[model samples]
Target chain A: MKEHLFEYLLRLGDDSLILGHRVSEWCGHGPILEEDIALTNISLDLIGQATSLLKYAGEVEGKGRDEDQLAFLRLEHDYKNCLLVEQLNGDFGMTIMRQFLFDAYRLPLFEALIHSSDSQLAAIAEKSLKETKYHYRHSAEWVIRLGDGTEESHERIQKAVNSLFKYHVDLFFTNHVDDALLKEGIVPEMKAIHNKWMESVKNVFSEATLEIPSNNWEQSGGRLGRHSEHLGLLLAEMQYMQRAYPNMEW
Target chain B: MSKNDWPLWEVFIRSKQGLNHKHVGSLRAADAEMAIENARDVYTRRSEGISIWVIESNNVYASDPSDMDSLFEPSQTKVYRHPTFYVVPDGISHM
Candidate 1:
């Protein structure tokens, strides 16, 4: 039970950590000054959520490791984030599309998790849900703006939707770890969250004049520790300071 | 500076429950909703506000700098407005 819970915590933590890092790349590069600040704020919020979850996971594992160690020292294959999050940020439209999809999924997931039988998980969900609400709104609004804005914006955003949808199913990937946690009421049902995700996506996309690709293709791997080559590249940059400095602190 | 087509909005934040929404800063957003969200990211990241209001910068009309003295000079001598002669009951701490 502890092992399954710990694995589940890593799943939650890694998603936030990786997506946080991915969005942090936009800190200085957002389309405008206000948007730059907004993206970085979202990044900080995700990283903060990751910190709490990883810290709890460390305690659950009864490891000497702390949140910093779990975050900055983990190997590429050890990360459990879904493939959607680890994908590269191609453009502002692409970034917003990616965030919209994830935020749509995350908001409902956290809302359901707030009722978890696990007291600490419920508490974390309650706190993180507030921040995720804003994130979802921000991204969803951007999706509408970009998708309906201009001929160029429409094309770019549509391309983003088409390309990124291939990884959408990976968001619902679950395994024995999820099974055990579900049995114990420590997590929410993935099926319900998936339905909610689809509904939210349909609403936002229709409003944005965007469409999910008709193809039902899917991809998976992050849950079982296998990851794209991109993870290795991302980890190298993320872990560089810690690897080189050997536990140095600012 | 306006970096993109989005219009600039002036942000006002109420720091606490009973406070007035005070002008903090400005940012560019596509519309009013984005303006409010942008203000949240820019001005309230440190729990600096409980509420926010945003208006387009274009909609605000400001007094000319040359009129500063004319607009304000009369108030300088109006010390009666300060209520310095009032005797207060001691229990009113905020006053």
Candidate 2:
């Protein structure tokens, strides 16, 4: 039970950590100065959430590992995040689409997790839910603006939606670990969350004048330890400082 | 890409619940909603405010610098309008 719980916690923690890293890539590179600052602020919120979650996961594992160790020392394949987060930040439109999809899923996931049988998980979810609400609004508003904006923005964002939509399924993937947690009431049912997520995506896409891709195929496996090539490159950059100087502290 | 510049907005922040909103700075945004969100990210990252108000910069009316003396010179001579004539009691430190 503890092991399954640990894996589940890692899945949650890694999602925030990796997505935080991806969003931080836009720190100085956003399309505009205001957006640059906004994306960076969102990145800070995600990394902060990751720190809290990974720290708690360490406590549950009863290992000597701490947040920094867990974050920086893990192998590329050791991460348990959904593949959606690891997707590259292609362009401003693509980045917004990626963030919107993740935020839509995360908002409800956190809302449900706030009632977890595990008190610590519930507390973390409560704190994170407030931040996720704002994130969802910001990203969703951008999606609407760009998708319904000029011809070029509409075309570019539509392409982004089609390319990124396939990764959304990975977020709700369930296996033995999720089954155990569900049986014990540590988490909510994925089916309900999935339905809610689909409704959100459909409503927003309708407003944005975008269409969901007809293809039902999905690319997954990050939760099972198989990742795309992007994760390797991302880790190399993220872990550089810690890897160079073991146990170094500012 | 749209060639037009995004509109500029002036940001005002209320540092605490009871405090008045004070002008902080300005930034460019596509609309009022984006302006508020941008103000939040740019100004309130340090937990500096409890509320934010953003107004389009173009909507603000400012007095010209050339009219500074004409606009303010009358107030300088109106000492009666000042409350300096009153003396506070020793027990009332704030007054």
TM-score of each: 0.93, 0.96
TM-score, structure 2 vs. true: 0.96
Where does candidate 2 clash, by residue pair?
Answer: none
At residue A14, candidate 2 shows an lDDT of: 96
For candidate 1 chain A, which ten residues in a row score worst on lDDT? A27-36
Per residue, candidate 2 scores C-alpha lDDT tens digits across A1-250 of 9888989999999999999999999988988888898999899899999999999999889888899999999999899999989999999999999999999999999999999999999999999999999999999999999998889999999999999988887899899999999999999999999999999999999999999998887988889989989999999999999999988998
Off by over 4 Å in 1: B1-4, B68-70, B74-95
B53 in model 1: Cα distance from truth in Å?
1.0
Measured against the native two-chain assembly using Cα atoms, what DockQ does each of the candidate structures obtain, in the order listed?
0.64, 0.65
Per-candidate iRMS values, in order, are: 1.8, 2.1
**Which lDDT tens digits does candidate 1 get at residues A151-213?**
999999999999999888889998888888999999999999999999999999999999889
- Residue A249, candidate 2: how far off, in angstroms? 1.7
The list of candidate 2 runs beyond 4 A from truth reads B1-3, B87-91
Q: What is the lDDT of candidate 2?
A: 0.93
Model 2 agreement with the true structure over B24-72: per-residue lDDT tens digits = 9999889999999999999998999999999999999999999999999
Score residue A128 of candidate 1 by CA lDDT: 97
